[model samples]
Target: MSIQLNHTIVAARDKETSAKFLSGVLGVPVGPRFGPFVPVEMSNGVTLDFIDTGGEPITAQHYAFLVSENEFDAIFGRIREAGMAYYADPHHAQPQQINHRDGGRGVYFDDPNGHNLEILTRPYGSGPP
Candidate 1:
């Protein structure tokens, strides 16, 4: 069988809160708890299993999501409504702007755990520059 990413553990101070935050942003439901994990499953069947770190410092990680235009709108709306700061580029040089890279919209924001989250309507290099 081809190798696929089935699940990954997302370290958070509060697993439930982190899971709910991600679910609300993505407009998807968080799955029922399994042991120490509160899972948030993506459309591709890959799960982001949130685990409590019990006050441990979380090393920020970057997660990029390729979403449709409609999905991007909805998710971006939520981001703005939450007053979350976003940037057009990954380096965060351009504030309050979205990038039209590869002929699609893209933005980068940080999660509660300080993880860099990116949402783009197109895959990089998939279209004309």
Candidate 2:
């Protein structure tokens, strides 16, 4: 009886590549396409539907995921293994490092579409911000 986010469209250069890239990094599966969308379903049941920019300029956006400590470890490992540049802060002032903000570990990285992606073990402001 409450409103929930069912899905969101993510602009990308190549939908399939972006969707698969996110899936691989998050250790999730890319769902079957519905029309032009290539979806990546999260554990919370919300889906990130990736779509092409259609010859338009793709504006980069930020997307963050909350994960368990173990999940963070796995995801962070994949990020490093992929040789992706990661930062401790959203502004990317700290490279190859993670922030211990709000008493939790967090890292930021960029996707194929230049979307700033973040993974954290704790929600922001859950502790001292």
Model 2: per-residue lDDT, tens digit, 23-129?
99999999999999999999999999999998799888999999999999999999999999999999999999999999999999999988999999999989964
Worst 10 residues of 1 by lDDT: 120-129
Worst 10 residues of 2 by lDDT: 120-129
User: Tens digit of lDDT per residue, candidate 1, span 2-121?
Assistant: 999999999999999999999998899999999999999999999999999989999998889999999999999999999999999888999999999989999999888988889999
Best by lDDT: 2
* TM-score, cand. 2 vs. native: 0.97
Question: What TM-score does structure 1 among the candidates reach?
Answer: 0.95
RMSD of each: 1.2, 1.4
Residue pairs of candidate 2 with colliding backbone atoms: none
Candidate 1 scores a C-alpha RMSD against the true structure in Å of 1.2
- Clashing residue pairs in all predictions, respectively, total 0, 0
